[model samples]
Target chain A: MQAAADLGAAAPSRRTEILDGLKITLPFMVGAAPFGVIFGALATSQPLHLSPFETMALSLFVFSGSAQFVAIALMAVATPAWVIWLVTFILNLRHTLYAATLVGYVRHLSLGWRFILSAGLTDETFAAMEDRYRRLGVHRNSHWAYLASIIGMHVNWNCWTMIGIAVGMQMKGLDGLGLEFAAIATFIGMVVQKLRTAGAQTAAAVAGILAALLAALPYKAGLTIATLVAIAVAVIFERHLERRGQA
Target chain B: MSVGIVILGMALINLVLRCPLFLVANHIRIPGIIEKALAHCPVAVLTAIIVPFALHLDQAPDGSQWLNPDLFATIAAVAASLLTRNLMATIAIGLGVAVSLRYLAVF
Candidate 1:
C-alpha cells in the first residue's frame, strides 16, 4: 500500500515538470506574434515589394527581430547590399554571446538536436532556458522542452507574419483601435517581468539611456557602440560587488 | 561587393562571435571574465538599439517640428517601466502617449 502510494506520487511529478516548463515557455509564441505582424507590414512598404510568402520566409530564415528591422530599414533607402549585410551582422553580433552561454547547458545533447536548437536560438528563448537550467541543473528532457518552446515561437512568429501581411493588405487604415498596439503591450509586459530584480532594473535603465544618447552615430553603429558601453559599465559595477562578495 | 562576398563575410563574422567560447571552455581556466562579459551582453545590446531612436526625438508643442516619436515613446516607456514596474502597461502607455501627442499636435 505504501509502495503503491509512492509510485502514484512520482508519476504525477514527472508529468508536472514537463507541463510547467511548457506553460511558461509557450507564451513567447503569442508575445512574438506582434513583431511578425509589424515585420510583415513594414516589409510590404519596402522597395522590394515582398509578397506575404516572402515576408514569412524572411521571418523564418532570419528570425532575428533586430536584424530583420535593420535589413528592411536599409533596403528602404536603397542602401547598398553589402552595407545592409554589414549592418545586420553588427546588430546580431550579440547572438554569439547567447550561443556561448547556452553551450554549457546543451553540450550533452545529440548533434541533430544541437544544430536544430542552434538555429532557433534567440535572446528570449536563451534567457528562458538559461533560467531553468540555472535553477535545476540540466536534465536530458529539459532540452526537449526547450526545443519545443523554440519551435513553438518560431512557428507562431512566422505564421503571424502571414496573418499581419493579410491584415495590412486588407485594411485601408486602422484608426483609434490600433491592433498594432499589441506588440508594444507585449514588450512592456515582458520588460516588466524582467525588471523585478534591482540588478536587472539598473542594467535596463543604464542601457536604454546610453542608447538614446548615442543615437546619431554613423551607420547606426552608435547603437551597437552604446550597447558595448552600457555592458562595460554594468560589468564594472558587478565586479565591484563581487569584490565585496555581494553577488 | 559581390553577393558571395557579402554572404561569406557575414557568415565568418557570425561564426567568430558565436563559437569561440565553446571551443576553448575545456582548454584554459578564466576567472569570472566570461561571466562578466556575458553579463554586459543584454545592456550593451539594448542600448545599441535604443539610444539613437531616443535622442532623435524632439517633442515641442509648436508646429515648429519638435518632438520625435521614438524619443518620446522611449521616455514614456522608461518612466512607465520604472513607476509601474509593469512592462506591458508601460509600453502601452508610452506608445499611446507618443501617438496621441503626435495626433494632437502636442509634444
Candidate 2:
C-alpha cells in the first residue's frame, strides 16, 4: 500500500506518531491472536472441510472475523452461497456506520488514500483510529497515526490468520489452548483507557448489558442496535448534565 | 461450489459498503450535535462488541452454564488496567487467569 499523502512540514513528526500508534495498539494484536487461531482451526473442520488455502484466502481477503466466521458456518451447512453472502453482508453492514463516523477525519484526502484506508478499516482499526482522531484532532501527523493504526492491525490480523492456518493444518484442536480469551482482555484494556468521563462510562455499561440481552437478535443486529441506543443514552444524559453546568 | 468464487463475491460486497462512504463523505455536512454523538460511538461500539464475546453463550467443558472463565478474566483485566494503567500487564494477568481457570475447571 501507498503511504498516506504527506502533509508537507507535518510529515517529519508523523513518523513518531506512527510509532506511538503502533506501540499503543500492541495489546490489541495480542488480544486478537487467539481468535485468529480459532478461525483457522474452524475452517478446516467437518462440514466446511475447506483446505487451509481456502481458509487463508477468506482471511486474506474478507479480513472481517465475524463475517468470515459466519461465512464458514453457513458454508458448512450448505447454506446457499447467496444467503451466506447476504448474511455476512448484513453482519458487516455495521462497517458503513463506522465509515460514516470516521470519514469526518479523512475527507480532505485523495481518493487513493481514502480507498486504501477504507480497505484497512475493520472494527478494531476503527476504534484505534477514532481514538487518535479524538485525542489529536486534525493535526498533520494525525494522518500518519491513522496509517499506523491501519497497517498495524492489518498486518497483525493477517499474520495471525496465516499462523493459525499453518498450525491447524498440522494439529487438531486449538480451543484447548485457551488463548481466545485474550480478546476480552484487549477490549477491556482499550475500554478502560478511554473512560475519561462518566458519560462515556455510562454508555459503555449500557451497551454491554444491552448487547448481552439482545444477542439473540439475528445477524448480529443486536450490536448495531445496542450501540445506537447506548450512544443516544449517553448523548442525552450528557446534554442534561450540561444544562446544569455539571458537564 | 467454488469456495474461491464465493469469497470473491463477499469481498466485492464488503468493499462496496466500506469504500463509497468515504468518497461520499466530502459531500455531507455533519451537525455539531451529530458530531458530539458520534464521539460516543467508538466506546459504545467496542463495549457492545466485547460483552457478547466475554460472556459467550457457548457451553464449558464442565457443563457449567452462564458462568465461565472469561467473565472472571474480564473483571480481572478491567481492574488491572485501571490500577496498572498498562496494556501489556493487563493482557498478561487477564489471559493468565482465564487460561488457568479453564485448565483448573474451577467453574
Best by DockQ: 2
Q: Candidate 1's residue-wise lDDT over A77-106, tens digit each?
A: 344666556556645655766776677766
Model 2, B43: alpha-carbon shift in Å?
2.9
Q: Score the docking of each candidate (DockQ).
A: 0.31, 0.41
Q: Lowest lDDT 10-mer window, candidate 1 chain A?
A: A1-10
Note the residue pairs that clash in candidate 2. none
State every prediction's TM-score relative to the real structure: 0.65, 0.61
In the range A1-247, model 2's lDDT, one tens digit per residue, is 1223443455548679889778767877777777687678667654356898888888878888767765775565354566566655655666777788788778877788889888778887888878867765665566677778778877888788877777666655444545655545656777799899978888898998887887766656667678778889998888888888963
Per-residue lDDT over B1-107 for candidate 2, one digit per residue giving the tens place of the 0 to 100 score:
67898899888878987898887665455566776676676678768766776676323212235577788888889899999998668878998988899889897
Error of 2 at A213 (Å): 3.7
* TM (B chain), model 2: 0.64
